[model samples]
Target: MPQHFLLSAEARNLSPIAIARMSEYEAVMTMKKLRWGEGKDVICPRCGKKHEAYYIKSRKQWQCKECNYRFSVTAGTLFAHHKLPLRDILFACSLYVNAAKGISALQIARDLNVQYKTAFVLLHKIKEALKVHKQRETMQLSGVVHMDATYVHSSQKPKNKKSERVDRRLKQHENPLKRAILVIRDSFAKQDDEQNTKQIGARNTIAFIAKSENSKVVNQLANKHITKGSTIHTDESPAYDNLIYFHDLKRVNHQKEYRSDAGVTNNLAESYFSRFKRMYYGQVHKMNNTYLYEYANEIAYREDTRRLSNGVIFNDVVSKCLTSLPSDDWRGYWQGNKKRVETLAA
Candidate 1:
C-alpha cells in the first residue's frame, strides 16, 4: 500500500513487447483461457461449465460435453461478438493500460489499423466493464473519509434557442441540466497491502451524479457510502450540517483558513475533483450525461489504481470484461437518454 508497491508491480508483469510477441492464436488462446478459468481449462461459454469442453483445434473453439454446444473462447462476452482478431484485442488492451490518463478512440484506431467505429466500441466496452466491476465491488469508506461535490455540465447545446435577452448568469449554463458529482475518498487507507487483498483502500471510492448539493443529497450519500463512527471531513458547506449528529463531523472554513484546529480538510476530495475536471474538460472534451456513471467510475478506478503498473491495470480491466455486459451499441451511444444519475452512484 506504500507507494513503493506500485513500482514493485511494474517489474512483475511481462513487458508489452513480450505479450505482443505472442502469436495471434496463442495470445487469444492464452487470454481466453485465463478469462474462463485456468490457462488449461477452457470454459463452455454456452453452458458456463469449466473443464467440460474439448478444444476443436481445427475450428478453434470448444465443444461443451454437457450441452454438446459449439462455441469460441470469446463467445458470450463482448470480445465474443467483435470481428477483430484476439491479438488486436490484446494489443488494444495494452494501449489501454499504458495510457494512464486515457487514450482516445482515434488513437486506438490509428494504432490498430481498425476503423474509428471499432476502436470506439472497444474502448467503450472496456469502460462499461470497469463500471460493472465498480458496481459489483462497491466499497464502504471507514477511517477518515472525505466527501465533496462538483459539477460537470451537460454537453447538449441549443442552436437558436438562446437570444440576446438571456440572462448573463443563465448563459454560463446554457444547458442548465448540470450533472452534479458526489465523491468520497478514504483518507486513511492505502490502495492495497503487499498481499493485494484490497484491505485498506484498493477500491474505496464513492461517486455518482446527484440532483443538487442539498442536505438531503449529502445526508443520503453519507449514510450509504460512509460507515458509522468514521470521521467525515468537509468544508463549511451547509449541506453537510445534517451529518454532524451521525458522524464524527469536522470541517474547515475555506474563507478563513484551509485547515481547522482539528487538522480537518477536504483536500483529498478536492484533489480528486481537480484531476477529474481536468480530465473531463481537457482530455475527453465533452461528456454525454447518459454514460456519466461509467466515466466517473473510470476516474475512480484510475485514481485508486494510479500506483499500479500499466500491466497490472490492463490485466484487471480485461479480467472484469469476462463477466461484463456491453453498454449501449454504436448507433445509440450518442443518443442521450438523460437517465438521472442520482441513486445510481457507482
Candidate 2:
C-alpha cells in the first residue's frame, strides 16, 4: 500500500529547529519577503503610500519619503507592538502549523520558555489573524455541502456521592455555558476531464457558534453561507428540515446508519467535528464561550488544509499574520483591554 501523505518526507518541508536557528537579521528579512514580496516597496501605515520607504539601518524601520512616517516590519499588522523577537514568533508559527489537532498555550509556553500569559496572547493573536484573513476572503461554499452541529461545555461532572449526582442530561441540569459549533463543509468534486467518477472529502469549511442547535439559528446561518440551489447533506435533525425550503436537502439518520442506501452522509461535517473534539478534549481541555467561534474556525482551517504540507500551511499562516490588521480585542489584552461580549450566530 502507498504511504500516507503526512508520513512522507514531502509533507515535512518545515523544521522548527531551522526557524529557531535563524538570526535576528534573517528573521527580519524573512518577514520582509513574506510581507512585501520580492519588491522593495514598503507601504507606510501612516501615509498609506506604496512608495519605497527609506530604511533606517540602526532601528531597522522604514521612513516613508511621502510623509516621513516610520514603521517596522510588523507595524500595523497583527504582530504590531510585539515584545518577543521575530525569530521566536516565526518559530511559534512553525510549531503551530505542525500541530495536527491544536496546540495549547501552556504547551507553547513550555516550548518557548515564555510566560503563560505571553504565550496565551501570542497564540490568540495568530488565531485572530487567521479569522480576519478568512473573513476578508468572504468565502461562500458551493456544490455538495455537508452540515452538522456539535456541542461543547454541555456535560457536568458527577458528584462523589451517587445520591448527590444530578441528571446532567436533563435540560434544566445542563450547563449554561453549553454552546454548539455549527459546521458547513463543501465537498471536493472530480474534474470533468478526470477519469475518476467519485466525489470525495471536503474542500472548504465554515463554522459558527450558537447557544444551541435550533432551527432559527440554523436557517439563518445556512441561508447566509450556502448558495441557493446547492445540495446540502445533513443528519436527520428537525433543525435542518427547514433547509429544504432553500436548497435540495439530503438527510441520513445517524440513529440507523452513518450512510444511507442512497449514498447520502454528513461525514464531511463529522470529519470536521472529529478533529475539533480532539483539540477540545485532548488539547484545550477548558474553553470559555466567549472565543469558542475562533477555536471552531481554527479547526475548520486545519481540516481544509489537511492535504497541504507543513511548509505551505506555515507560509499561509504567516502571510495571514502579516496582512491582518492589529487586533482590537487582543492589542492590550494583558493590560485589561479585552472583548466583553461573546460572538454568537444570529
- Top lDDT prediction, candidate number: 2
What's the C-alpha lDDT at position 109 in model 1?
A: 94
Worst 10 residues of 1 by lDDT: 337-346
Candidate 2 colliding pairs: none
**Model 2 lDDT tens row, 1-346:** 9798899999999999999999988898889889888778877898789877898877878899988888999998999998899999999999999999999999999999999999999999888988887777777788999999989888877899999999887899999888989999998886634755453588899999999999999888887888988999999888988899879999999999999999999999888999999999999998878888889989989998998899999989998999988878997788999888888997
Instruction: Tell me the TM-score of each prediction against the true structure.
Output: 0.83, 0.95
Q: Write the per-residue lDDT of candidate 1 for residues 80-119, one digit (tens) a residue.
A: 5667877788888888877656677888899889888779
Model 1 RMSD in angstroms? 4.3
Each prediction's Cα RMSD? 4.3, 2.0
Pick the TM-score winner. 2
